[model samples]
Target: MPAARESLLDAARTSLARRPWSTVRMVDVAALAGVSRQTLYNEFGGKDGLARSLVRRETDRYLAGAERALAEGGLPAAADWTVTRARENALLRAVLTGCWTEGLPAPAPTAAPSTSPVPAQRRADGPLPTPAEVIALVRDRAVAVLAPATSTAGARATLARDCEVALRLALSCLLAPAGDGGTAGLVREAVAPIPYGAGR
Candidate 1:
């Protein structure tokens, strides 16, 4: 089922890239995934559910990548990852910035209860994160991984502020383009303990 689910999602993503989400046919998606329409329905509950799941999957991957970057190279690397990902993915960029352009499927938050038996679908049916929430989520993740156990309350608070600033800087880089190296250098400067403080 997991493999089938991923196949359906992959097909959907390819279809989305080719045309508008509005014109994407469920039957086509099912055929592309090599599953029946009823299987798609059982997996996703419907198109709205599929949309939510798609967004949720991207959001999860985005956060996972940020966490990995943070673990590997701290806040600046995470910022670099953020800028890179947002630049490459229109849906993710829109999700991060709260800007949904034409032809994109922007999944709205649902007030109705989810009755999907699928665990992933049920989670997807839950409230999706807004742009602000995405920022805070990434910032908090940075703090969680980067914060030292011995750091004081004030130190952790300062770290949180710095993480938020670095993340926002990444977002800014999306709105305003950077050089060939993209956000790495700019993010490194912003997250530096003492930016531009001394000669090399």
Candidate 2:
């Protein structure tokens, strides 16, 4: 059997995966993990702490995957950049979709979901890649993928930015919510200009 902390963490992950993070409570987590509330508190320092740990754990996994993708050439190499952005979207999506405002309040030990009535300071709806960051990630990786493609300094910069946009669009498509059309539409619009197999 997993240790208490591990059990609690796994329970939190499972619960969050099913319901919004705001819906999950420490009592619920303890019940699901088959541990005592005190055990959860002792290990996680309460709900917000647990949520932070969950985010950190997921972030670590994403970074590990990104590093590995960088090592392996091909689309997977570019996948490093895509995966980081995808993970951020997933986290943000969760916060946005799972909020409790006019309800009886979220279960104890957890902070009200970040997307509650107060609203998230960092809103979910925005440019997928923020343009600049994606441009940099792609440009740095481009030398490896686009070394053979002839281009002057200005041309290479333009190509890199376009490729980053293309990547962001692809990820947005892949990670779109099952029913939501916004991400899908954004992806379609963004990808129309970039040609594939042009970089690799």
Candidate 3:
């Protein structure tokens, strides 16, 4: 009776909570959701399709909150990143990491490393983007989103950078310990100029 997307999301969330992203099976999600495997395939096409939907759903929620807060000058932008950082914190990371919660013991602790091992740390060989460079990108995208004067190319570049920064921030939030708040302050700082200047 639920909408197809909501039903799919509910099933996907349950499966993700039980196991790592790689191990989650579409069949399991369909079973949990009470939908036939054919229906699941018809709706989502595949696991990758479902993952993208999940990402978009989560991102849409965050963006809605950001839009609401952005009304108070550029403060909303800062608030948006802060909220996003909190959502991506250790708790979410633990879920993402495929470690067991209180329930779902059959999977077992020794089922295999839930996440991939990182390659040896290495220095960057190319020109590195400074935080300011990253911020400029955020600003450009915000302008394109909020202001009609900014050109599409300018906005596209900025949007791309914002995405890059968001990924880095997500990683930091997931890896860092509690109370650190990850790179929230940095994201806030980066996002501030957009809303503040747009109203000028």
In terms of lDDT, which candidate is strongest? 1
Full-model lDDT, candidate 3: 0.47
Each model's TM-score, in the order given?
0.92, 0.47, 0.47
Alpha-carbon local distance difference test for all models: 0.82, 0.50, 0.47
* Sliding window of 10 residues with minimal summed lDDT for model 2: 118-127
RMSD of 3: 11.4
Score residue 135 of candidate 3 by CA lDDT.
40
| Inter-residue clash pairs, candidate 3 | none
Model 3, position 11: C-alpha lDDT score:
79
Q: Order the candidate numbers by TM-score, best to worst.
A: 1, 2, 3
Model 1 agreement with the true structure over 87-161: per-residue lDDT tens digits: 888889988998988787888779987888898888999999998998889878866787767777887777778
Q: Write down the TM-score for model 2.
A: 0.47
Clashing pairs in 1: none
| Candidate 1's TM-score | 0.92
